[model samples]
Target: MAGLHLAQLNIGRLRYEVGDPRMAEFIDNLAFVNDLAERSPGFVWRYEDDSGSAIETRPFASDPRMAINLSVWDSVEALERFVWQTVHKRFYGRRHEWFERMDERYFVMWWVPAEHRPTVQEAVERLRHLRQHGPSDHAFGWESLPAAQLWKSARCA
Candidate 1:
């Protein structure tokens, strides 16, 4: 916790375009969620564009509907608390209504120096490493956490 921060990247395939009627609810809630994260305890940083929304930044040029979120927190516990113990959990519960099911693991987490902010390419590379090599100290998911770890409280059921 002294020198390291947790960096995470999660990519989702959207079932519909951001402006589509089907995605309206998700779109409407995006700002609120973003602001919540900004105010959440232990929040460090999040990737955003000039509009302060990451949704418009298409990381995967081939798929216009691919949405990615990259953020940093003081620890896994901080991130888990925000994700599982807040209103964000409600939207997360309804993710399937806005996002398509992904066949592969779409999330990855790794440790970074507290002062370091990860780039999109670096986050993608870590995700690729996890996909190709499975979890390790370099890249991991909730499954990689030890049973006694704080992640247990935040782990998805």
Candidate 2:
């Protein structure tokens, strides 16, 4: 059988103020959304820790605003639709209202085969790749998704 790979999506948010009310609402709903996605179409596996809760500042976790979650899915389209075409879309639209208004530096998507849930360290590297290179065969985003099918990452980004 073909090897399995799971596409991983990672995102982060910078906080101007930590205890803002809107920030609370964003956090609340973000968890709910992740919960919903875990059960939705093409869902396979996701990061054990919620992306919204984890933050660190170091070479690997250099961005204080950065957070992480990764999942293994059956197909890239399955993952993309779940991100842009669902309640998750609302979160995407309102990032500016809640977080810093930076051009898409905080979120990134890339492919891995099944059974491979990436760690925070791996997720950070993938985000770096997408920033260094636009969407390509190795690193990509939702807009650059391949045709409808599964993917197996010979190597993780």
Candidate 3:
């Protein structure tokens, strides 16, 4: 617990191209939401490009519309508070307006050294592991809360 951090990666497919008028609202609010995260209590670090936005960094090259978000937090509660108790909740509730519905898992959480900054490729592999093998100490999600806790216990032991 003293030397670890929680890392999260979430991916989504856009309903339209970045320049499309329909995506204007989401695009405009991106900076605001990202800023909120940086100012939040448990914020550690977030992946950003030269434009200060990760939207254009398409890790999934096969889908140009896919967007990825990777960040580190002090704890799960910190991330949850920022997500559910902030303006982000509003935009998240309206995700259907901008992102397509994916039957597969698109979000993942894992543990790493406190000083470690996870890379896109590493996060992608964890996500893939979760999608293919389900939740484990390797990677988990909100739906698999127990696995998240399991890692902490294992580490302590």
Candidate 4:
């Protein structure tokens, strides 16, 4: 660990408004999954508003239907465990029912200082970098780089 936290941003285009009956199941599970992530090992922080989840936040100003999730984890492994090993996995499996299949990259990851809390603007820039340039040290995808190398590269950035 280089005292660098992993910052991740994932955007999804909703199939319907969150309050719609069609999205009830997904909306109903938000709190449980959010609580699970907060309690999970190595969890640091997540983007939230008065509603307690960022699902209502629209990072893409042009797309009201887009929902964004941004979070920081102590390490890649910690994030992977939370997403793949917990009850959240069930929601991940059913994501297609609520979210549209995006043609472009919907997620991006980067390294930040331990104390840094990334903003939505920063996340948008990272996602843009990933979309425009593919994966690089500055912005990457789910396929991660070695922590040592990633931290070194991030520092150089």
Candidate 5:
């Protein structure tokens, strides 16, 4: 038996208050987008609730002004296929239409063992570590996979 690979997710804000009048409409559209993903192919699972949010234990940033949307995915191909191939790619391209280009630190990816979904706090810590240290000895992204794949029986059904 082997552990599953999870896509550690993170998306930052454009401005301080993304829910402001100017951005409210866009934020509201998130529900529609999420709904699309929930039913997307390769969508093993997503973290959200009726309120259209999952919980976050960390401050969006050191200033605490920004916020993050973190979630898990079954695989990099799955997530990338969604983010790039899907309509979602348009929003990502236009993110600067809202968000600031801080650094690579703004978005990151890491691996997690199956059955051990990370908490917001843990995700934050992993991002912080990635910033302080480089990719080695800890986390990596879509471009990197272990020499050996850790495949497991599908729990999807």
Candidate 6:
């Protein structure tokens, strides 16, 4: 558990295009939320492109409107604090206004080596695994195992 980190991937399908007026607020706040994540305690890394955010990256081939966010945190608590206890929470509250409500699971979390930077392919596979197998050490949803057990069980697998 000494060198383990938490890697998380969350995807959402936008109800409108990034430049659409309907999504103006969400688009406007992307950088602020990303900045908050970078400044949060226990923040490690986030996937970004030349524009400094991954909002425009199309990792999911099947859906062009799907936006992917991948990042690593020192612990589950650190990620939680950034997600639920910051300005990002306001955006989260209004997600339904900008993004479609997905029926399938749109996010996954897993343990990775401290230095490992997860790729989009890896995140996609984890999401697929979670969808197909429910919550396991390899890939899980929000109601995941404790970090200690998750690392141990993932190692054993």
Clashes of each: 0, 8, 0, 0, 2, 0
Clashing pairs in 3: none
True-vs-predicted CA distance for residue 14, candidate 5, Å: 3.2
Candidate 1 ranges with C-alpha deviation above 4 Å: 147-157
Instruction: Give the alpha carbon lDDT tens digit for every residue of 1-157 in model 2.
Output: 1565556756646564445675777766766887888888888877664244343323244465555556777776676667666887777667667666556655566656556677767777777777888777666765565463322221122
Return the TM-score for each candidate structure: 0.92, 0.73, 0.91, 0.90, 0.76, 0.90
Candidate 5 lDDT, 1-157, residue by residue in tens: 1466554656564564644686665576677777777777656556664466642323565654455666666776666666666667666666766666665665556666766666766777777877788675465543354431221221100
lDDT of 6 by residue, 65-130 (tens): 999899999988787777766887678778889989898888889999999999998998999999
Q: Name the 10 consecutive residues with the lowest summed lDDT in model 3.
A: 148-157
- Superior candidate under lDDT, 4 versus 5: 4
Model 6 regions more than 4 Å off: 146-157
Q: Report lDDT per candidate.
A: 0.86, 0.62, 0.86, 0.84, 0.59, 0.84
State the displacement of the C-alpha of residue 40, model 5, in Å, after optimal TM-score superposition: 1.9
**Residue 90 Cα positional deviation in candidate 5, in Å, after optimal superposition:** 0.9
Task: Kindly give the stretch of ten consecutive residues in candidate 1 with the minimal lDDT sum.
Answer: 148-157
Task: Name the lDDT of candidate 6.
Answer: 0.84
Residue range with the least summed lDDT across 10 consecutive positions in model 5: 148-157
Cα lDDT of model 1 by residue, 31-127, tens digit: 9999999999999999987667788877778999998889999987788888888898888879999999888889999999999999988998999
Model 5, residue 19: C-alpha shift (Å):
3.8
Residue 104 alpha-carbon offset, candidate 5, angstroms:
4.5
